[model samples]
Target chain A: METPLIRLVNVHKRFGNKTVLRGISLDIMEGKTTAIIGKSGEGKSVLLKHIIGLMQPNGGEILYREKPIKEMSREETRVFRNKMSYMFQGCALFDSLNIFENIALPLKEGTQLSPSEIKKMVGERLRQLDLEGTENQYPSQISGGMMKRVAMARALVTNPELVLFDEPTTGLDPIRKNAVHSMIASYQKELGFTALVVSHEIPDIFHIAQNIIMLDEGQIVFSGSSEEIQTCETPVVRQFLRGEAGSMFID
Target chain B: MTMHESPTQGSGILHSLGAIVLYRIQLAGHFTLFLAAGFYHIFSWPIQIRKILQQVYFIGAKSLLVIFLTALFTGMVLGLQGYYSLVSFGSEAFLGSAVALTLIRELGPVLTAIMVAARAGSAMTAEIGILRISEQVDALKTMNIHPVRYLFSPRLAAAIISIPLLASVFNVVGIIGGYLTGSKLLGVNPGVYFLRVESSILLSDVTGGLLKSLVFSIVVATVCCYQGYFTHRRKNSFGSKSVGLSTTSAVVQSSVLILITDYILTSILL
Candidate 1:
């Protein structure tokens, strides 16, 4: 009924001769968790990257709040970037920094918050992620699942309006994977931030994700809500849900 | 094994040669702009004094022991060699001038730069390369922080400030070491040696050495940081192996550039 929070139209991306995203078009609604489930190397991460301006599209356009991202001015771009955050697959925390400092970095660099205020905000995120006592510990000192939580904390530290998660729970055990999903769901609810997740967690992710977008060879074969995905008889969608699209179960 | 030449071989070879020259020029242009941006950012508002101080500690303070030892040993050797050479010429009284002139005019800055290329420069390449490989640089960009300003400019500023000071220290310690070897070990008169050292070193020589150190520092910082910053673009793909190669290339290229630059500057300064 209203304009989408972000929109991608006929986006094309290629690395060398390999066209990763072949005219991809999608819409991400506001304040909703949208999961992009696709086979490995299907340009899911590349798609997320294009949305965040990490990589520009070879063709077409990405619009944020009805404004074409590339057409925005320098100050406008800064404002746009400030309103979003990305959680890398590897949990790309600053290794040299301790957890507290890692979480505080965005707030310290991006905002004019005082030292005490930054400490308070970081402490709050740390508590939300159950990273309470690990503030002084470095990323290497923490567990893989905990590192994901720390990354989540850092991403949420800036109170962004849009957060991109790339395989947020891929390497974690099932319990931890669900935990990360639940954490994202809860954070999305509490913060009401639009989320775009490039993940393969399948049904587990579907439980938390309201909308589902399926990619097959970088082309969106299915786009609808979780219920629509389950009932859709499209061959590609069925093959993907049946774990035949070079990935695990999703239906 | 030589392959048979095709009809277009001559033209193809010329085309490739032209491409290589163009590529090299492009690279030089990129490097100039990168270094210029780093230098320009050093003057931006909210001067990153704290980060610069940290870099100075890493680049300068940590280098004290090695620079001291190298300067001392190098000076001692110069003293021994000069004394022996001048003794046969019956001019051993000029050993102070020989050691001071060599260290102040040439060896001091060259050796200090080479040492730093080994220590701080290589380490910088590896550190920044790892960050690039780990996506921390991308993270910084997404956070709206300029990676060049955050990672590179401070190191450049620190290297610019540190290398000259370290070279000066190298000269001082080297002169003292020469005194120790010539006056204390050999039979040269301490008074004559000191007097020669004071008189032989012209103001131009000292300034020239300082200038060389500054240029060498810029070369070392630019080459190494640029290598690390572009580690992902290596033909082999982005990985720890690429980072390793970038570090090695940075060290080798910086060392070669330093020696070549030294020769050019020496011709002009002399």
Candidate 2:
């Protein structure tokens, strides 16, 4: 009933001659967990990038709290950026910075928080992610799973309203993947913030998401509740769900 | 390449010369604006001091050992060469002038710049390129920090200050090396050589070389940083190879530009 927290209206993105997103339209409700499941190179990441204004759409607009993001001033865009968190596919932590500094960066740079305050908050996030006692270590010193958690911690440090997760469980072992999923679920549950997760891990997506959106060839093939997704007879949806040997997604 | 006497050849040479002049004018215009920005930051006191110190660490302290070693050996080699050449002319007393003129007018700053290009320039290009590829530069922008103000302008200011000082040091060290070679190794009277050098060389030659050093410092800093920072294809597509290409190109472009500018400035000033 309430207006969506974020919305993409007929968005189009093209790379050279190839069109990646052709009139993509989606509305992300406030305080909801929405999982975007699609095959590789289906513009799932492109959709997330548009929301953050990292890549502007060639056609149409992205709205944050019903305001057009496309026409926002540079200062407004920066302010908007700080209000959302993005976990890059590879964890994207600065190699030169230690975990403590990495987690503390947004708060230190964007906020007027004192050093002690930042330290206290970073410590809490580290403990939440079960990454305690590794503050002084560089990103290179940690395992991939831990680096993901570190990135998650940094993303959460700013207390963003919207968090974008790009394939959070792709590289993790099953146990670690489950661990990441649970932490993500818990964080969203407790914070009551909107999350837009892009992933191909169908089981994990179904387990964590209340809502599901399926992307194919840069267009939304299906959008519904998780239960609706499970029962949908759409060929693409069925193929993705079954993890079939050969499907329309094959080529 | 034989020097062919043809009207078309003359036109081609004129065209290339015209293109080079135009490029140099553009470079000078951009360089002037860069220098003006640096000059503005100079009055900010502590912030400027902090920036200057950081750059000094990068451009001066890090470059000391290479500049010194290069200068010393280059001086020694020049000394040996000059002594033998002077002996053939029966003007062995002119050995000091020969070494001094070579080091002051050409080799010292040019050699230092080449060394900096190979060492600092490549390193800077690779580091910035990696940052660019990794989206760290994007991250900085997202935080509303200007990459130029935060990362590059400081290095440019530091290079301006450090390169000229290093060039002076190189000239001194090289002259010392030449003196040692002349007196101890080549059996030339050091007094005659010093006298000839002091009488022949003027303040203008030293000034001209120092001027070149200042210009070369800017060339090295701007070309390297610009190449890395401006490299844009798309996200994730850029990697180490782009950085490597930019690094090599920066060095080659900066070196060739320095040589050409050196000739033009020398002709005008001297």
Candidate 3:
């Protein structure tokens, strides 16, 4: 068996008196797309945050390539963080920065690239995202789909080995959503990078994920291949995939 | 748990102590870097003079009325207090020196900084803190441009340089107010008062106050920025309460630091 690129060992998290995650364990394979599907508030984004080292699990550990994320020192974390990119759910582009500057930021800070080299690299990424002409526009100046693309371009400008995406299609129209999904698929395939995508858009992720994990109330209720999920006889998975209200959810 | 300890009680105390030490170190480091970055921005002149002129209109020119009113009352009070003290010593003729020294060397910078902290510094903290909580800071961080370099350097630079200049204006106007109050209302000799002031006051007194103002600027900017910058989470975690707390802390912390530093500088310089 291949060594998993990302691993969570009995991860747990809580907020004050309420438990948000409870001993969740999973392995994400290298260079494959993994989709985490769940209801709106079932620790999906929380799991993404754990992988990116944005939040620490209250108990247990999260590992990237056998290295525990919490054990890394500040400088080590900076280096580790540079190797992975996160596309936030809201496409959190800097409102103060134009598209070109936003995409070029990580390269300019993390690499020894000259200004012209950084410009060229940013231009290439923009071209890849079909955002070549919108380089000078601010985040607020663009549509949500274009903003998502800009964020993706920024994330990929450094050519990270792992990408964590939170609801990449969440506020876009269906057409734009499909466009973003296709772009994510193409980028993963072209770069051979590991992707952990969090979303409720089941059909789009069904086309993209090599493996699927279903989270319910902070626990991994189902874990299998996309085909396995399709064939599973569980009422929760079937109802979720069919868009029906099930007993798994209230109301 | 120890005999004296409730569950997790000692741990909380230890953490609070550690946090205090950590915050002190962070504040010192932040203020040092802030000062250096501010000087660099000032010397580099990255921002155009037109913008500075515009800010002066807002930060300095618009603040003139308040500064004047506050200074006038402050100087008048100082003069009244000085006359009584000087009469006790049979040196009421030294009233000009008393008013000038107090206004120029102490109250001028400290009071001006407190006012600016109340007016401008709180607004700055609120604006930047809201921007931070809204994911703007994360956006800047991901862009690879140091938010400190882009966002903080200019404001810190402007505050350090401008606050002292504003204080000087306040001092000069305050001394003139004192002279009017002392010589016109109190029947003191203007020539005697002016002569005593000219002989008694030194350039070092004004320098001490300006230096204090510079320190005040660094304290205000660093505390405001650090509190805002560190408290933001790139999600739905940030809100108006954090901004409000940060602004209030900036004003209070900066005011206290200004007062403490004023005493220290006075003792050292005088």
Worst window of 10 by summed lDDT in candidate 3 chain A: A242-251
Rank the candidate models, highest TM-score first: 1, 2, 3
Once superposed on the true structure, which residue ranges of model 1 sit more than 4 Å away at CA?
Answer: A245-251, B1-7
Candidate topping DockQ:
1
- 1 against 3, candidate with superior TM-score: 1
Could you give candidate 3's per-residue lDDT for residues B22-55 as a string of tens digits? 9879868866776576557544534535444544
Q: Assign candidate 3 its CAPRI class.
A: acceptable
Query: Per-residue lDDT tens digits of candidate 2, residues A175-245?
Result: 99999889889999988778999988877778888889999888999999999999999987898889874
Write model 1 residue lDDT over B166-260, tens digit each, in one string: 99999999998988888899989999999999999999999999999999999999999999999998987669999999999999999999999
Per-candidate Cα RMSD to the true structure, in Å, reads 2.6, 5.8, 6.2
* Model 1 DockQ (Cα-based): 0.80
DockQ, cand. 3 = 0.26
Error of 3 at A19 (Å): 1.9
lDDT per residue (tens digit) for residues B196-245 in model 2: 77887889889988998998898788777776775554243457777777
List ranges where model 2 is wrong by over 4 Å: A249-251, B1-55, B87-91, B139-150, B191-203, B230-238
Q: State the TM-score of the second chain for every model.
A: 0.96, 0.82, 0.83
